[model samples]
Target: MNVLVIGKGGREHALVQKLSESPMVDELYAAPGNAGITEATCVDIVETDIDGLIALVHSKDIGMTIVGPEAPLELGIADRFHEAGLKVFAPTQKAALLEGSKSYAKAFMQRHEIPSAAYATFSDPEAAKDYIQAQGVPIVVKADGLAAGKGVVVAETTEEAIEAVDDMLVNKRFADAGATVVIEEFMEGKEFSLMAFVNGKDVYPMITARDHKRAYNQDKGPNTGGMGGYAPVPDVSAEDLTFSYEHILQKTADGLIAEGRSFTGVLYAGLMMTQEGPKVIEFNTRFGDPETQIILPLMKNDLLQVFEDVLAGKDPELEWEDQASVGVVLAANGYPEAYKKGMPIPQINGNVYTAYAGVAGTDEQLVANGGRVLLVGAKNDTAPEAAKTVYQALKQIDNNTDYFYRTDIGL
Candidate 1:
C-alpha cells in the first residue's frame, strides 16, 4: 500500500524511514520533507494544506496518511481527509485539544481522576500574578494554546514566574497562544515520555523514553522541543512503567472515549515519576521529535502494520529490541530562541543514523534551515553506550561554530 507521512521534522523523518522499511508499504512519501529524509519521495505540499493533501492522496492513490505533527492535526486535517473519503491516522480537532490547550488538558485530567500537578487557569495577567504570589515560587506556567513546545516555564522564583506571566499575557510573547495560561504546582521527580498507539480503550504503550528538554548541559538553559533522548530508560522501574500504563495511558484512553472523543493516533504522555507514583506533566497527540528518532529504531514490528492493527481495533502485540538507543539534537547555536539559518551543515558519516529537521539540501552540502537541524542517533547494549556512539558521530561533523548540542544526553 502507498502511504503518505505528514509534517517536516525529525519525527516525520523517523516515520518516513521506518515506513520505508515496511514491505507492506509499496510507496512511501513525505509532505514538505526536510533534506535528510532519503527513504521517501518528498512532496511539496505543506502539512496544513488540507485541500492540497487530499487532492494528492487521490491523484497518487495513497492508501493511508499518517500525521506526525500536532499543528495539522489541530487544524482538523484528519477530519478533512475523512470527509474526502480518505483513510487517515490521527485524532480529530476536538480530541487534539488535549495537547492544543493546556487548560483543557488539566481539566480533562481533573475530570478523569488522572494523576497530575494541581493547577489553576487565568486569562487576566493581574489575577495570574496574584495566584503565583499566593502559590509562591517553583511553579509551572504554561500557555493555554500550543507554543511549539516553548510555552512552558518551570519558574524557580516568583519574579521569574511573574515575568513569564507578563511575557505571555502582557508582552504577547507567545501571541494568542498565551492569551490564557495554566499555572500548576511544581511536581518533583524524574520525567519520562510514554507514547501509545491508542484506539479508544485499546491502548498499546511503547517503551519508555526520557527527553532532555533543557537546551544546555547539566539541565541548564531554556526549554526546547527536546535537546536529546534515550529509550528504555534504565532508571524507570518495571513497576513504575506498569503504574503509568494503567493509571495514565489506559485511563486517558477510556476517559476520551467517555467524553465522546475517541483518540485514533499516537497519544504521548509526558510523565513524571514522582515519589507517590507516575503523574502526567502534559500530553502530545502525535509522536515526539527526538524521542521518536530513538524509539522507532528499536522497534521490531513493521511500522505500517502497527498502525493498521491499532486502527483496526486489533492487538499489534508490539515487539521491541533489547538494545538501547540514544539521539542528540544538533540545533542552531541560539536555538529555542533567535538564531541564524542557512549555515552550511557538515557531512556526517559512519554508523550513526540521522533524522533531519530544519535543513535544506544544496548542490554542495546541506545547510541549517531551521532552529534544530537534525538528530544523530545510535543503538547499543546500554543507554550510555548508545549515547557515546552518538556523541562520537556528532564529533565527526567538521568543526563549525553555527550549531551546538547538549554534551550530556543519556547519562
Candidate 2:
C-alpha cells in the first residue's frame, strides 16, 4: 500500500524514513517534506491545507495517511479525511484538545484523578497575577493554547512569574493563545517522554525516551522544541514504566473514552519523575519530534502494520530492538531567538541517519531554513555509545560553529 505522511519537520522525516522500511508499504510520500527525506517522494502541500492534502491523497491513491505534528490534527485534518472516506492515522479535533488547550488538559487530568501538578486557569491578567503572587516563587505559566512548545515559562521568582503572566495575558506575547493561561506550581524532577500508539483504550507504549528541552548544555537555556533525545533511558526503571502505564496512560485513555472522545493515534505523555512518582507535566496528541527521531530507529516492527492494526482496533504486536539510539538536533545560530537562515550545509559523511527539520533548496544544495536545521541519529549497544557515534558524525559537518547542539545528551 502507498502511504502518505504529513508535516514538514524532523519528526515527519523520521516517520517517512521508518515507514519506508515497512514491507507493507509499496510507496511512501511526504507532504512538504524536507531535504533529509530522500527515501520518499515529497509533495508540495502544506500540512494544514486539508483540502489540498485530500486532493493529493486521491491523486496519489494513498492507502493510508499518517499525521506527524499537532497543528494539522488541531485543524481537524483527520475529520476531513474521514468525512471523505479516507483512512488517516490521527485523533479527532475534539480529542486533540489534550494538547491544544492547556486549561482543558489540566481539568481533564483533575477529573480523572491523574497525578499532575496543581494548577489554576485564568483569563484576567490581574487574576492570574494575583494567583501567581499567592502561589509564590518557582511557578510554571503556560499559554492556554498552543505556542509551538515555547509558550511555557518556568519562573524562579515572583517577579518573573508576574512578568510572564503579564506577557501572556496583558502584553499579548502569544496573542489569543495566551489570552487565557494555566499557572501551576513547578515540580522538580527529571522529565522524560512516554509515547504510545492508541486505539481507544488499547494503548501500546513505546520505549522510553528522554529529551533535552533546553537549548544549551546542562539543561540551561530556553526550550526550542527539543535539542536532543535518547531511547530506552537507563535510569527509568521497568517498575516505573509499569506504574506510568497503569496510573497515567491507561487512566488517560479511559478518561478520554468516558468523555466521549475516543482517541486514535499517538498519545505522548511528558512525564516528570517527581518524589511522588511519575506525574504528567504535559500531554501531546502526536509524536514527539526529536524523541521520535531516536525511538523510531529502535523500533523493529513494521510501522505501517502498526498503524493499520490500530486503525482497525486490533491489538498490534509491537517489537523494539534492544539497542539504544540517540539523536542530536543541529540548530541554526541563535536558535530559540532570532537567527540567520539559508546557510549552506556541507555534506556529512558517516553511518549516522539525518532527519531534516528545516532546510531549503534542492537535495544537492540544501540550506538551513528554520531554527532547527537537522537531526543526526546513531544507534549502538548503549545510550552513551550511541551518543558518541552521533556526536562523531556531527563533527564531520562543516561550519560546526554556525550550529549548536547539546553535548550532554545520553550522558
Candidate 3:
C-alpha cells in the first residue's frame, strides 16, 4: 500500500526510511521532505494545509497518512482525513491539546493524578510576576502555546523569572504563544524521552531515549530543537520504564479516553527522573526529532505494520534490536538563532545514517536550508560505542566549523 508521511524534518526522514523498508509498502511519499530522504517521493504539499493534504491523499490513493510534526496534528489534519474516510496515523485536534496548550495539559495531569511538577497558569504579567516572587527562584516558565520547542525558559533567579514573564506576557517574545504562561517549580533530575503508541487505553512503550536540548556543551546556552540523543538510556532502569508505562502512559491514555478524546497516535512523555520518582516535564503528541532519528534505527519491526495495527485498535508487536543508537544533529552555525544557509555539503560515508532535517539543492549537491541541517546516527552494542561511531563519521564531513553539534552527547 502507498503511505504518505507528513512534514520535512529528520523525524519524517527516519519514518520514510523505515517505511520504505517495509515489504507491505508498495510506494512511499513525503510531504515537503528533506534532501537526505532519497528513498521516498517528495511531494509539494505543506504540512499545515489540511485541505491540500486531504486532496493529495485522495489523489495519490494514499492508504495511510503518517504525520511527523506536531503542528499539522494540532491543526486537525487527522480529523479531516478521518472525515474523508482516510486512515491517518495521528491524534485528533481535541486530543492534541496535550501538547498544544500547556495549561490544558497541566490541568489534565492534575485531574488524572499524573505525576508532574506543580504549576499555575497566568495571563496577566503583573499577576504572573507576583506569583513568581512568591514562589521563589529556579522555576520553569512556559508559553501556553507552541513556540517551536523554544517557548520554555528555566530561570535560576527571581529577576530572571520576572524578566521571562515580562518577555512572554508583555514583550510578547513568543507572540500569541506567550499570551498565557504556565510557571512551575523546577525539578532537578536527569531527563529521558519515553514515546509510546496509543489507541485509547492501549499504550505500548518504546525504548527510552535521552536528548540534549541545550545548544552548547555542558548543558549551557539556550535550548534548540535538539542537539543529539541516544536510545536505551543507561540511567533509566527497567523499573523506571515500567513505572512510566503504568503510572504515566496508561493513565494519560485513560484520562484522554474518559474526556471523550481517545488518542490514536504517538504519545511522547518528556520525563525527569527525580529523587522521588519519574515525573513528566512535558508531553508531545508526535514523535520527537533527534530521538526518532536514533530510535528508528534500532526498531526491528516494520513501522508501516505497526501504524496499521495501532490504528485498528489492535496491539502491535514491536521489536527492537539489542543495540544502542546515537544521533547527533549538525546545525547551521549560530543555530536556534540567525544563521547562514545554502552552504554546500560534502558526501557523508561510513556506517552512519543521515536523516536530513534541512537541505535544498540538486541531487549533485546539497546545501543547508534551515537551522538544523541533518542528523547522523550510528548503532552499536553500547551507547558509548554508538556515540564513537557517530562522531567518527561526523568528523569525515569536511570543514566541520560550518556546523555545530554537541560533543557531550551520550557521554
Q: Candidate 2 at residue 164, lDDT?
A: 89
Q: Residues 70-118, candidate 3, lDDT per residue (tens digit)? A: 8897789888988999999899999999999999999999999999999
Evaluate all candidate structures by whole-model CA lDDT and list the values in order: 0.92, 0.90, 0.91
Off by over 4 Å in 3: none
Candidate 2 runs further than 4 Å off: 397-399
lDDT rank, highest first?
1, 3, 2
Per-residue lDDT of candidate 2, residues 98-152 (tens digit): 9999999999999999999999999998988888888788999999998998899
Using lDDT as the yardstick, the better of models 1 and 2 is 1
Provide the global lDDT of candidate 1 against the true structure.
0.92
lDDT of 3 at 261: 85
> Which tens-of-lDDT digit does each residue in 1-411 have in candidate 1?
999999999999999989988999988889988777889888999989988999889989999999998889889998898888898999999899999999989999999999999999999999999999999989999999989999999999999999999999999998989999999999999999999999889999999999999999998989999998999888888998998889899999999999999888999999998999889999999998788999999999999999999989999999999999999999998898899988888777767998899999854688889998899999999999998888888887537788999989986
How far out, in Å, is residue 181 in model 1? 0.4
For candidate 3, the lDDT comes to 0.91
Instruction: Report model 2's TM-score to 2 decimal places.
Output: 0.98
